[model samples]
Target: MTTRVRDERGSAAIEAAIGLPAFVLFVGMIIAGGRLAIAHQSVQAAAADAARAASISRDARTADATARREAEASLANQQIDCRSTRVSVSTAAFRVPVGQAADVTVTVSCRLDLSDLSVPGIPGSRVVRATMSSPIDTWRERAARGFRIPDAYADVWGQS
Candidate 1:
């Protein structure tokens, strides 16, 4: 009587075929996670920059525009390709009287594209948001409210 030997031919090929896809999927997931983390950090930085920029402005209108522009510039500098971006500036602090404590807040939202990763179960895009606030200088001169006497006419108008 002869013992039968099991034929192991093609077993390696089958194992490779099964393992390769799983390996690819794992790598894809890692790449996707890393991308998201970096994007979040970048967005946070953008929000900080925006808040600081807005806080330095003398008026609410200028703060709004400056915050948006600074956020966009920060994202661009970081090479983040956002499909859509929204920058919201809360300048309510601008209403605060001079010589008082106030702060400017900025929120930045960026929609990042993940379709290129082609990772299964991952959304085609994700929105990352960050909010930051910066204190305005307590002694900084802010825009005057209501009617103001012109510098040239201040003497005649008695400095309203």
Candidate 2:
């Protein structure tokens, strides 16, 4: 009985050793996932804000241009490096309503690659992207707003 219990004691230690690294890895993945989720949400908010700004104010691309700046602000609040943020916008020529605006699409993407920044032990970074569609102040249609895309424009579904 003593020999058997002693053998089981070593087995528990061995099991612990084997499980520790895996448990740590799982926890790390969870943390990484959460951080990436936050980044994605920030991008999405920035895109929405930019698109709304563009549509309501007829700012067009200028509105989309604010996405990065606003997103950076959000990341700053989160204490995350947002210097790698990229933002874009696509607007449909079709108006939202007779007296309203057209619709603009805004997209934000970011990759937190700390290799260039030289953070230690973090291994790899993450990439997050978000897109939003906003109404623009065009003179087309509110009730019968036809989806008039520009020659150089494509929706997210169209992008390969």
Candidate 3:
């Protein structure tokens, strides 16, 4: 009687050929997820900064301009290169009278590019948006009022 042995040659190579693509895909997913997370945090921070800047402005016109500038500067500082950006400021609070609680809202939108990652399932670009609100100083004077006083002085003078 004769016995035959099975040949196992090239089995390792076959396994590696199948596994390498899967490993590469997993790494790509991790990179894409990390990039998205960082972008989200950056956008949130930009919105907060913009809202704060707008809240401090004395007039609606100034608030709109200030919010846009602050958002752009904040994103640039973080070294985020956006394909497109949009900053929207809600100045309705500016119309509210002093001594009443009011807040300014700023929305920041950024289009992030991810084509270089070459991730098959992921989109070439993603739009990330964040909205933040900052309370306007209750005692601070508005454009309607001719008087303008610092927040510290407003409290000291019992403006509230």
Candidate 4:
């Protein structure tokens, strides 16, 4: 009985040494997945903000500038740092004729760095992208011509 007990004394230590690394690697993967999910949500929010800002503009030229600024600001507010970032806007719909519905589209992309995970077979970076659209105000004038009050409103315009 004494001889058998001596042989088993160091087995637990040896097993722990062999299993620790695998266990740590599994935990690391879970953390990396969570980080990716956060990045994705941030990108989506940025896209939504960009589209909303652009949709309020009267023309494609101003919409383009507004979208870019809103997207950058949103990402900064969310505290997301990307290895690379891109914001794209599609304004084709804004050129529609008056009385027709129009929409502004914004797309955001970010390359998230995963180097800290130090896991093999996983890319050092991954891309996350989101797209969103917001409708342009149907009644807003598209050009600088502006809008004139209707005959019905003209009588009441100065009464107040």
Candidate 2 wrongly placed segments (more than 4 Å): 1-7, 61-68, 91-101, 114-120, 137-160
Task: Judging by TM-score against the true structure, name the best candidate.
Answer: 1
Clashes of each: 0, 7, 0, 0
Model 1 weakest 10-residue run by lDDT: 115-124
TM-score of each: 0.84, 0.63, 0.83, 0.79
> For model 1, how does the per-residue alpha-carbon lDDT over 32-71 read when each residue is reduced to its tens digit?
8887899999999999999999999999999999999999
lDDT, each prediction = 0.90, 0.61, 0.90, 0.85
- Model 4 scores what on Cα lDDT? 0.85
Ten residues in sequence with the least summed lDDT for candidate 3: 115-124
Question: What's the lDDT for candidate 1?
Answer: 0.90
- CA shift at 49, candidate 4, in angstroms? 0.5
lDDT winner between candidates 2 and 3: 3
User: For residues 1-160, could you state the per-residue lDDT of candidate 2 as single tens digits?
Assistant: 3554344558878999999999987887777667667666766776677666655543334454564456556656656566477777665433333565446677777777644233256666666788888655456433323445455655644742
Instruction: Candidate 1: list runs displaced more than 4 Å.
Output: 1-3, 116-123, 147-160
As for candidate 2, its clashing pairs are 96-101, 97-142, 101-136, 101-137, 101-138, 102-136, 102-138
Q: By the lDDT metric, which is better: model 3 or model 4?
A: 3
The residue-by-residue lDDT of candidate 3 on 1-160, one tens digit each, is 9999999999999999999999998988898888789989999999999999999999888999999999999999998889999999999998888899999999999998887334654557889999999999998877844555667789888775
